[model samples]
Target: MKVYKQAKIVHETLKRLRVRIDWLQRKLIDASHISTLVERMEGIESARVNKGAKSVVIRYDGKPETRLAVLDFLDRLEPTNLPYVQQSNSEEKHFFHASLNGLALAASPFLTPGQRLALAGALVAPTIWEGIDSLFSGSVKVELLDAIAIGVATSRGDAITALSTNFFIHLGELLEAKTNNNSNALLRQLLHPAPTSAWKEQNGELTKVAADQLKLNDVVAVNPGDTIPVDGQVLSGTAQVNESSVTGESVPVNKEAHMRVLSGTIVEEGTLRIRAVKVGDDTTTARISRFIQDSLENKSETQKKAEKKANQRILITLGLGALTFLLTRDFTRVASVFLVDYSCALKLSTPVAMKSTMYKCAKNGILVKGGQVIETFADIDTVVFDKTGTLTHGELDVIEVESVQPQEWPKDRLLALVASIEEHSTHPVANAVVTNAKAHELPHINHSEVNFIVAHGMVSEVNGKRVVIGSRHFLEEHENVDIAPYEELIIRLENKGLILLYTSMDSVLTGVIGLRDQLREDAKSMIDRLYANGVARIAILTGDRARKAHALAEQLGIKEVYADLRPEEKAAIVQQIKDQGRKLAFVGDGVNDAPALVNADVGIAMPQGADLARASADIVLTDDNISGVAEAYEKSRDTMKLIQSNFKWAVGINSGLFVGASMGWTSPVVSSLLHNGTTLGVLARALSGVRER
Candidate 1:
């Protein structure tokens, strides 16, 4: 096997050399405008043509015998069997050997242009011989052989070319992580903390890890500007980490100690030493990365069924072709049809088109995470969204202020005091109060004995008096404040989708501040377009209450609502949709949406989402608009159509060429030309998507 492989390599090199020299000679003529030389080479007026002296010959049988003789002479100078054979250590000798080797590879009859280029390109590097030797001597050869065999079985059109391309692509993938040259400085920086240990557990579970050390339940300090080295509980400190790459949140959030912190988050501020509860591959980051890698490599159940059917069809066709060829003793004819089936065109076309679309999306400030996600999006029939950060402006605005009597209270003064009490809070209502105070240039009033009622309101003393500012419930339940006449104002604000905050002094409702959450500017238009584009149902899923979800959905023309759901509950809702036989897509931008993104058939996370959410989602919209959801699906569907069209053309043309060859209508040279020409045509069609506006 080694001798045969070596001989074949040598033969191919010489054929490539001849092609290059022939090409260079033509270029020389073009450069100098040598009309007489060209005429002489054509042998127009000569009776006999010189065989080797700047001459050209057109032959019926492709001149294989003549090419073989030239290759035989080159082989005598240096043979693959002889280690480190060299006629001279000069640059010309190296070029001469390389060109000869390329020509020999090209002439092998088994190799195509792509195959020849890939093989010859490898020889230009110094490591080629070492790897080849290693493959021959070590058990690693078995793995390499398996990869090659898989390439052959799974590939269609030009077996050598497919194998060669796969080999180089895989090699590139392997080397990408290790290379740190100047040209790849940015890439190196991005993958510096690359996944080091990826392991599959005995129970068919996979995990990942980056750090060298991890201990059980030890509180690990994940400070600001630091990455979470392991999963742990936030034992101390107040910080908000961006886990968009891992979870997908468009905004950073305030996290206090006692909350569980997953691995792979960028702490924006504050410090929290979390107890290392998960070790090694069990960490969240490792598991997520492993999931992505597995999803990319392992065929989904649907894909497996499709592939099985494709394989059966191909096998049946192969059997029929073989039977026909044996009966007619026409191997060339049989090989032609087998060489150009639609599968190769489909594979290349879909990926190339998808990659191009992804690039286009990036240019437009949208990121479709991967080709696989794009494929899934093309099948979506419904899209669900989160309301607060996703649909609303996420900040409340104080639209109105009212008093018991029309002119009884100074609105600005009342708002100033409310803002003072809520100054230190970060809730939407608190922000609204602060904004109102800022807008009116209200003077600050120092408050003492300030106490926070979680998710209800704030209580404090300002101007040496007790004050209460919060919802109706907070006043009635906590401060025992009465609002007999303020009820009308509160009802009015609620009808407008606003939350009213009542201010009380000494158990009496003094005034009310009406704050409303505004809809996002592009929210309605984007959602409307999505509905027009065949989206049968659209829903809003949020952690907020039912009223909030329903109000946002009503304004955005979304009829469905799933509200007050936790992160895990959101994922369950997505799973329920899938169970109901609906193709569901989720659009979210929070750590809470991570599981939902992973669970949905198609997950479209905002580019601004938390690290975890972005990584979990298959597609990301950088524009942070809901309309991109529809656009992505449209592009994907178009890509799939192009793939199908290219596949049909590739298979159809090859089949016709095979039929022509079988009846002696086409010669070997013509068949070879047609075979490569069809492949080129398919590539051209695939690339046509690039010109799409």
Candidate 2:
């Protein structure tokens, strides 16, 4: 068994060595053109002083056929007397010795066959000869014999030798490992496998459905800590979802049945069984994932154009280098240049930079989902916004209520009654009513049998009295309450973008409470800054009526408005802007704006939005500030610029080295060192982050 184990170890080493030899042989063979130079050039001349003090007759003829003529002369020379050859230059001394050295060494009887073969091959192979030249040529030189020994060590599989040859390879693999594992892990995870979703069989069948099939009402289920797989309505159970990955909100939210959830959100609590109203490809989650994948697969238009130019330039240079090498028979130098020029730098740099920039944005609470989004932000001709909650604080302020029977019920009692009924509802309206009621110090009403109406209002019995609080239409249609006269008050609030709710007791109008969504403190300033940052236009799209949307748009200096838009309509509007040569970025609390979010060049979600929207957006704002958008753009532009610079340096150095090598100005050792240096330099530069403005 021990013998068998030893045999196995030897076999494995042999196999590994075989692989290395194959790789080296392939590369060296590709470089063999350089070795022919020695066979094609020759020195034959005699120039010396005679004792008679007469000018010595020096015969010299340097021509392309000189090497052939010298060979013919050698074949005819007599072997009886001692042969003495003369040379005119020191370079010729080394060149002549190199050619004859192999034959002389091979003729020796003392040296082993392996040693003889190795020495003979070294004399003729440009690679080996160049190694000698490198070590002996300049001030920055090692001994010629030392270089040969090192090259032998490398060829013979010495660990240190392998390390020297593989410096750039190992460094690149290490840096790529670090990058793929840490900062860009998320993007890499999404991109590395090409997604099981995009997998295709040999047959023409598609493996996955497109994303748009997923709908809001679909039943979906995702376990704890898992990303929400699809967008759907929660049918049962409660859990806190960490939407920060999608929406940039660090805080987790409590979500229950009937609440809409999005994809890419992590479930932080109890299991949820959701009803998938949309499935297959149309779902919002699928669309968002599709966008991310597409962004990764497709370069921006500008990048594609740049790559085309770069590729053409590289091809032209390679062609020129090849032609020159063939004409001059300078195979040694040709090999050096070919080894140094790799297309990876130009091909990979920009995409990596863009990916890293996007990650940086995620770190700072902004998530730009795709390359398209980053490019779009760089050219945002117009900006649009939703008024309520987006521009305004989204919090409702309750100042006062005009009671129908002022003497009959105190305002505090009426608000308390309304708040008790609204406690079970989760809408912004409910929160406003509840907060205002608490602030007034009104006695809490013990309410029972509460019922909620989706997108409308709520109802409950307080002290055996039917209390109602909601939209006027909700009360008038459901309870047969007369709300015509209340229209005047509703109109007044509507013009200011405030949603009005009517309160009634047993079908009798008690009073009307006006709820206003206050403006965010930073709304105007953030919008102005976005404008100053080269944003060309700003607009708002919302489900609310035009009057209210327009009112808030005016306040925020927005010039465009689209109100009372269904989710599909909003998406169409976004598409329209995109069609008009403007890159649209939709920022919303994800719940009601999903389609539009997906339609925009970039979907930006706030922490407060539904999980689905966060997942749909490329960028999530952690602090929910609009200014984060601009900051993200700045980082992206800078990172991309660095990527371009890295490519330029990488390609430039390699191309320059190729020229140097071809001219015989560079030796094997120098070329190898340069190749390693250029590659490592490019990677290092790419890793460096952009400076802050």
Candidate 3:
């Protein structure tokens, strides 16, 4: 708290606070870090630090508690408290190793045969060491095959062949290393968690600090709307926590003192003080996020198969080389036989294709999380979409307004009355009504105390008449309003996928408001494109009623539909589809969709989706465009197609060369050039799209 003692509050307001710090004049503290730290606290919007005036200005949401929290954070921050950022130079390592290998190859013509052989040996030392290590370890792999080939070339004083083979091997290493590094970097960006801070309660006082700084056994205070920062037992207070991210449950669980709580769950209501038993990287959120990050290193089935094929081919090459040398007593044939293995192209082409496609997808506003996701997308047979946000605009709009009794209540007046009542609540349907009324410049009508009912509607007294605005169930059943006369109109609207809100005045139906999500203009076209690209089945899942969900599916020409489902039910359906031996992809955009997103073979999250949804998804569209899913599907197939083509080309040509060398038909120089030439050519084809302009 050394820095805190020297700082003073200079100006204060409901939404803005300015603080003076003396150390900023001397450049002793990191102002950028301070701004980022304070701005992440709940209710804070921005923090600007001024090094010249030695002051920090913070703008926060207009909440009294938020103002207190900002000051608390600044008061507890110390001079030594700043996050350390490490810089990565894998790109530099790639360049440096590449320069050395390039020099060895390019300078070969200027040296004598003996000098060339010596230099090639130095350059190929690592591969030879790896081969010797693998030899003792009793494993036959591509590295051992490559080392033996180069070793035979050197033993026979064939420097050009030795240098050529070693150079191409290094080239493939550089390609795979560079691609893996860049993929991991992009995944890190997409997997970053929401800004987090915690309130540490010690000795009867609360202090705000970065969540990562929390220690085991530290007591933390969490409020409504705050993400819980630890996996621990609640020390005091009570709250309802949404554990959907972990348990896949739609309902928030009630938590009280002595109950256990997990990190990443949000406090929906009330407050709680928790004692942290696990902190920092040990928490569940970090572990799950790490699981996502592990995708960067985990190889896909295609990559494994490629490496397996390469390793299996190594034994064939070694056996052929030994047989030829034993039969003909010729070292040249032995070197040619050893150099003609299919290891290089088979092992390197898959990574090159995967990395190139990832870069392409990123540029096209799609982020394929890993090579595994790309592999899955290549074979995806089924696609499931969340109805509201995935297929149509998540925002509801007023499609039509009709008055049941026009003689007593007109449409405009009904809209205004509904808007006035609905504006008091913040539901999506209510917001649409309020927005439509405002667009027409309608004034708010005076009403009695508005009572908001959960999952029903709004009720109040307007002009001394009991007025209710809600659904058919709320008005007809709950309020005893008679709406049996307009049953046909209701049915027609529901058939068209319009969600209706019924209004009643004094036990009589007065009006109906039809609200519906506007379908994305390209939705149908996107579906058609999916079908054209070989998707076998398409379906929709929604929490909406069966009528509305069916109406949307029919409009989109989709035959399969699941409706009125909770979050867990949606996930169950996804698993069921997957269990049928169908390769499925699920697209979603809400916090409740996390479970299904996780369960699908490949999950695609819309860019505007909630944090948990994006984190759970394997593929994320970086833009709002829904058609990117179709684009990604096409790209994945093309990349896999390229890999397969290269696999065939490598095997077909190298097998011919191996047979020629066994018959002493192809020389060592011809074998090395043709083998490395095809390997480099296919690798170039795989990386053709990834080149920067």
TM-score for each predicted model, relative to the true structure: 0.57, 0.56, 0.67
Error of 2 at 546 (Å): 1.4
lDDT of candidate 1 over 115-156, digit per residue (tens): 654554444233334334546774232123223322332233
lDDT of each residue in 1-693, candidate 3, tens digit only: 223465588998778878987776544454555675576567889999887798999998989767766665676656653332212323444455456667877998899877988887787777678888888898887667667777877877777777666666565556655544444343333232333578899789999887878999999999999889898899899999987554335579899988788787889999999999878776755654554444445578999999998988888888888888889998878877877878778877787678667756765667676688889999999999998888887888899899988887889998999999999998989989999999999988999999988899889999999999888888877889888888899888888889899999998999899988878888898999999999999999999888888888888899999999999999999999999999999999999899999999999998667778977998877556788888899888888887888888888888888889888898766776677677777777776633331
RMSD of 1: 18.4
- Winner on TM-score between 2 and 3 is 3
lDDT of each structure?
0.56, 0.57, 0.79
lDDT (Cα, tens digit) per residue for candidate 2, span 1-693: 212211111112211210011121221121111111112212435322222222122233545344333333322222121111111112223434434543443354666656554554444344345546764665212122223433444455332322232332233434443443233334432211101111112244433322233444544455575456565678788999986645557789899988877555668888887665545354443444444444455566655755665555555545655775787875445544444444445544555666666656655656466666677677666666655556766777775576777787777777777887787887777788888877777777788888777777777876677887777888888888997876776677677766678888898888877776777777787788777767787888888888878877888788788999887888888888888988777888747777877887777776556767766776766555766766866676666668667866876787787678677787544665676566556655554556655
Candidate 3, residue 107: CA error in Å? 9.1
Q: How many collisions per candidate?
A: 44, 36, 0
Task: Give the higher-TM-score candidate: 1 or 3.
Answer: 3
RMSD of each candidate relative to the true structure: 18.4, 21.7, 12.2
Overlapping backbone residue pairs in candidate 3 total: 0
Ranking by TM-score: 3, 1, 2
